[model samples]
Target chain A: MSQTVELKVDLGERSYPIYIGENLIGDTGAYLNKHGFKTGSPILIVTDETIAPYYLDTVVNSLRSAGYTVVTHIVPAGEQTKSLSMLEAIVTTALTGNLDRNSAVIALGGGVIGDLAGFVAATYMRGIRFIQIPTTILAHDSSVGGKVAVNHKLAKNIIGAFHQPDYVLYDVTTLRTLSPREVRSGLAEMVKHGLIWDEAFVDWLEESASKLLNLDLDALKYGIHQGCRIKSVVVAEDERENDLRAILNLGHTIGHALEAVAGYGELLHGEAIAIGMVGASLLAQKLGYSSDIYTRTKALLQKFELPVSLPKHYDVDAIMEAMSHDKKFKEGKMVFVIPTAIGKVEINRNVPAEWVRETVEQLKGEA
Target chain B: MSQTVELKVDLGERSYPIYIGENLIGDTGAYLNKHGFKTGSPILIVTDETIAPYYLDTVVNSLRSAGYTVVTHIVPAGEQTKSLSMLEAIVTTALTGNLDRNSAVIALGGGVIGDLAGFVAATYMRGIRFIQIPTTILAHDSSVGGKVAVNHKLAKNIIGAFHQPDYVLYDVTTLRTLSPREVRSGLAEMVKHGLIWDEAFVDWLEESASKLLNLDLDALKYGIHQGCRIKSVVVAEDERENDLRAILNLGHTIGHALEAVAGYGELLHGEAIAIGMVGASLLAQKLGYSSDIYTRTKALLQKFELPVSLPKHYDVDAIMEAMSHDKKFKEGKMVFVIPTAIGKVEINRNVPAEWVRETVEQLKGEA
Candidate 1:
């Protein structure tokens, strides 16, 4: 059974939906077929090794049942594999699959597949329609947004485009396949969303930390819904994160640095995000914006077994050096997403390196 | 005297204008200063080697005057530089330059620079703001649409994202420094817009081809404006190119395959398009679209010294192979954009490999 979640991105005609439920990918072909998708047109299923083994069969079976010509391309999983090589292989796969301009691409798995596959759709034949069937919880953030990209060796999400999926079917039932670590990782963005825009939501998250950690289905649904809602609203107001969107990066400044410092795959994005949130909280304390929330935030994250400190082997100086290259650094000053208070954050474009250094040092000791 | 052209992307609020003028690199300081741009901000000027000698200094000096901390990363000149390696180099340069999120990147050359630089912006730190100061006629097309990306060694424009610039400044005076071949190169897109969307504009170009060749300022302005207007309409209707945007690739299917077949940098982008239009026209005729128009197109391209025939040494099968790897090929079939008539076009996704090969052979042998 599939449940549909309607999201209006507010971009007039560019607006789309998020169809959430179980057995959705199987029905995706039928849905499109009903929507006038031509018969015998090839359906390209793009996935990463990580998720293909788990869901690729189910999805392909669904397509087969729908009377569509289906083909699949599986690439090595991990951020490192998101490259021109993968793109070319997928294009080759898409070509051999006999896809045409009107043929659909189904992106399976999480952000990596969504991005890699979306990019292929954006450029293939100039542009092709793609559907996102995200498997990871973290994809709640990536999937709702049309920002599809691959990581260049030096930068994450470097090679990409804003190619919106014709439809995004987030089968929540897929969450059963995710490890707790993945769930924890997805929480980071949720927490960041709360810190940046919704204090009440942050309070709700803090109050419901245990339920979330337990993967309470209802709480999980609420979490995904709220996360998508917040993201959808921001996207509606600022479809492209040109201005107001910067607010969404409350914990990303330090989060990205921690990811880079620890290496791409070492730290689960949520663990780094946990540290980033802590770092953000410390920045808030330093700037006198309610240091108390830092403790509460860390406590809740710690409850979830997410990292509350820097990775022990990571070097602070190296992290700060990585910080310098962050997208948030403005005018050569590392901008901190310091909380003004719970549910309130400001882009602290003025936090000195000394503050980052001191906070990083303390976090290292904590680690 | 930098001339300014407004790129009306139609997103409202997120909407900003692109300034195309003479000495934009010099006048750019005031704009940066007025925008509250601070000092010591890392400024990555993404440029190709060809335009570096003629213009990099001016861009650097202008930003420096605005108190921006600045740096330059140069890629080999020409279309081929829009590659994964180039993307990595830009990221590495930014990492080495210590650019922060607050930093800005100035794309200081033509289409290649704008696309690569914008991709750098989209990915570096997960995105940094970039401004475009396009120096070639080709940029009128590349700069306006939010499409930023690079080509794979095996595919053309295969890896990329839709990263729009904060502003784009097109200095027609920049054309003063461009080679005549470069100027002619941009005419291809202008001609493309005319064929796909603006029939009167195509008629205008047909009559003004001589003046355009002579670099008449009025002719240049009209060409740029007309080309952009068609793009503006299309992008506005489909910012993500989901539907109407495909029309913009009027001759690019064959054009891109040619570029990839001959090697990425072998043919200037516009020159390939000139040939592609000739080839697409023949494809159009074979499908009973327009023989007279195809003949006229071949003659016009011949007059401009653009290659109407396929490259002398490249095999037709090899070209077809390259086309097969084209990102547009889906489900084991090739999709071709052929004109219905001189001023009209239709996309045929059902085209077979045999037809593409036969057409290539026929065109390769044509006078």
Candidate 2:
């Protein structure tokens, strides 16, 4: 049986909806029209080489069947694709395709495609419209938040923007193709949603772990809906990360640093974040913010086969240096999202650098 | 004796003041601090080769003297400096200088530097703060509207964003170094301000032409202030160019096409716009929208020693083709800002393309 779930991100005029369903890719044109995208203006579909073979044609054909003038830009699949060079390439394609101010760019892959295409939409002639079509589990989080960016050679997401999409079309049917490693990596963010603000979600996600891993459609739909609902609420309150939005960066501070130090190819984004969340819990325990947060977080991640410890070879100094380059780093202070309980976090702006150094060292010895 | 005039652009929180005065470059640090820019976070001063010899050091030394950390990025002075390659280079300088979210970028040259550096500030970490230090007469128009962009190989301002600056510091003293051609070129936009929204200013500009040409401080200050005030009002109502802001593009439609067809190097931006305004008036008269606009506009531009007609050598077909690629081009119709009267214009989306081709042809024979 096919089913669909919908949630809205309430941002006044910038607000948009997130649609989670089975086989939604084939109906993208209808969704776009429902959201007021004009068929007379052109649409650019930005996807990756890996995903193009499966879903690109379907999306293009659907849009074309519905009378949209469509252009496709296929980029190589990887984190490296999120570069300024790639952005310029996409912009060239957009220009060649004659995409005007009324045009919209559709991101038809996972987080990388979403970020890259969203950014292209954000800056092309001072921003047009953007749509996100998530083909990976990780995108459930990236697609909804409107935090689009491309990596800088010196740091991650160093050049980017807060461009909200018209809506996100999350077809979980596409997630069936993800490799086992990709699946595990994607679940890290799902667990993050639970850890940040919803204790009940964490408990439910734990109970439904096997069902989610098995690709049970009902479980997947419910889990994604909850994750997006939580995210949309947080984003609605802090669209620009002015204040409450920092909570969403709970594990990203350490996760982004780890990704930067590891050259972006060593670990999947979610795997890095899984380890970062555990490290945060350990730091929480060290600070007496929580007594058993470290143990509980480690166990939950272990069940999902997510990495909860850093490798011994990665340098602590490199990790620290990368964190300082982060957008969250302020005035030489080490800012961190510290877990206080199973479903609560606090942004600590003055976390001692030496303490973080000790926590990075401790992560390697754990498990 | 030196004089100063301050004007505010009212976009609520995005609102900032424009300061028109003599020797403001030497006081750049005080103004930045007054605007609430932090002294602790590093600042990137982006300038160009032509202006670097005169004002860069004064600006840098003052900032340093005020206990500020400053990094300088200087590029070749030309329209070409507003390219993605140049933007990437400046981003590298910003990264190497360790500019974080709290940091601000100071555009210390003319329109080219302001557009390029403002774009860097717009996207670097998804937009930080930006300050415009306009060094040319033309920047009075470009610096106020928050329309920052870089050109593409195929078109002008094909990539851009509406990121307003924290404030504008216009030091008329810098205008003294401009060559006669440069001075006249800069005044085209000053004339545009009068033609679009203030007829009294046009009569005043015609009367004070020699004073402005001679770099008389009082005349220059008043002219720049009026230009900025009119632009700020238009932008405040439609910050994103949705409706009323199209008035700012009065001459830009043909002006951009002329610049694009001329390969960007042959004609100064304001000179191209001066000729475009003449073409616009010619088109208005052809459309029966106005009668004396053509003669009056051509005479005023001639009085300022600005170009009032397109060069005969340039291909008319090429200009028409370039117009189709412009940001202002929509659908198959010719969208132009047509002057219905000396102090007003209307956005006509259904202007015949053949009529525009005819107007472009007519511009070559005028005067």
Candidate 3:
């Protein structure tokens, strides 16, 4: 048995644990028991086509061995699949499968599947219990915080709810199957965790970059463990993004706009966010909130081979239009989570649109 | 100004006040301020075409006078509009209106709008604040409990969440515009509240049956007040329907089946529930859980001119199939909220299909 680290997201009645370890999926029964999931309850395992072939059977077999009835729902893999149609299909499958409120939905893939399945569980029969079984490194961030949604043509994650999961069962062994780009994309968020909340962790990640990129078991475990710990604390303090939780969107304001401009799936979520982090830092430095941090963040992102500037094809006008539609905008003003220092950020809703345009222009020139 | 009754549905932080009175819609600004809704926040008012012509401007003007940016989204009226497509349209409208996380969605119509708009609010930007503005007597019941959803071809309310609203602003004056059939439909749920929770309230309802059906303001106010009080207590004690809340569904098991068979608009929701109450009472009588209460219940329903028998067109096999698909089923056994007395009920999950079939056959004979 590989070492396990258990962290509880303290949400009072909705609080649940995040269990991170290597090869935890092999001992699924033990984790289910430890978390007090009743054996033999019907389970719906929701995954994407890309993820099902590798680990679906392993999970189904374990649950079946424990006398639980398991049903598998396979959605086509990709960001484009996250829509209202997919949500309806999943709900239809759950109803057709005769799954009831007592039955649990297991999100057994990456962020897309976790989001789709989590929303299904959140609304099926006015909400049912669901557990997250993350399969990719990117999921280390998405799997926690209970913010699940599908994208709209106008906005990503515009239609969703804040539904916490029963527990998150993350097995780092699954990260072995990730492609190199996937590995790098996942690291962006882990680095974000460091930049927004922990300077020491950022330095540690800088030193351990190669091990993390190479998927060393201990390095991967530690990265995900620290990322989830930071996220759990933030979510516990502000489950709804009413205050402290908004800081978690450090790179997201610009990142989400870039993704929308790139037409989703063209740019991986973490890749867009990586550029977003750089844009936010540049704006922060220009605003005199910080000096040198923008260069420092750019260097860190470069070390991980993540994009440190906006893509040349994305014009400032298009990016600004997309950002204007972001849900974070308040009272007709765009809200940007700006990094003021290493491990410190501020939600500045008063950022002038011209400043953002100018920063994007400069970033484009550098690119 | 008509007499007002203020009741609170307490779910800790999720608790909200239900303001019941006549002409309350005219004082919309006062209510919004009382609820701490900041002026100048964007508001999306979701109403149906039928309601928009009647009261939309009044509400929009009130908020606009207070410097709030109000956007009105008018859906077509009726049961057929309660669909995933309609939900998609509403969400799209909210997105197009540039409504953000700080925005509020006001459900400004009857039960269908409440469920649809509430689901939109419940999921829009991962749940935003929403207030229920119920315009029909039937909405008095649907608006309070925060059970919001749209219909699927396979099931009604199959896709939804238990998202409590910030407040329920029910102006009984709106009920004055309802047709007699609409009045009858709304009364069914109120009668169910009396049948399942309070025997004295049932007696009072029976005495005031004519007044309620004729839309007497005081009778309508008292009936809705008592119904909400009962529902509030039940929801407070069991918000998720783990046990006690199931009793609130006394007539809904077979009632939902009848509505499904009747094809949504063929029979109004309350008419179906009225028939469902009779079906359940007959089943209760067959199971020896009650004596003449079934007869007493049928007489009371008839007094309000509510349907007391399943449609003659419905067959036992078809209704059974529909009930089997209900979300209430657990482990292949059907759950029924069977009334054992005028003001008492039990969640009987072990009811034999044979007993239900016989009762439906008898109900058809009576029809």
The numbered model that scores best in DockQ is 3
Candidates 1 and 3, the one with greater DockQ: 3
For residues A192-246, what per-residue lDDT tens digits would candidate 3 score against the true structure? Answer: 9999999999999889989989999999889999999998899889888789988
- Name model 3 segments beyond 4 Å from true: A263-267, A287-292, A310-314, A327-335, A349-355, A364-367, B263-266, B284-292, B310-313, B327-334, B349-352, B364-367
Put down candidate 2 lDDT per residue, B93-114, tens digits, no spaces: 9989988789999998888888
True contacts kept of each: 0.29, 0.78, 0.89
Q: Which wins on TM-score, candidate 1 or candidate 3?
A: 3
Report every candidate's CA lDDT: 0.76, 0.88, 0.85
Q: What value does the lDDT take at residue B296 in candidate 3?
A: 90
| Candidate number of the best TM-score | 2
**lDDT tens string, model 3, B223-326?**
88899999999999988777898888888888878877776468888998998899888888878875688889999999999878766767778888888767
For model 1 the local lDDT of residue A35 reads 59
Off by over 4 Å in 1: A1-14, A19-41, A82-85, A98-100, A103-105, A111-130, A137-149, A152-173, A177-219, A226-267, A271-367, B1-40, B62-68, B100-115, B121-148, B161-367
Record all residue pairs in model 2 with backbone atoms less than 3 Å apart, i.e. clashing: none
Query: Docking category for candidate 3?
Result: medium
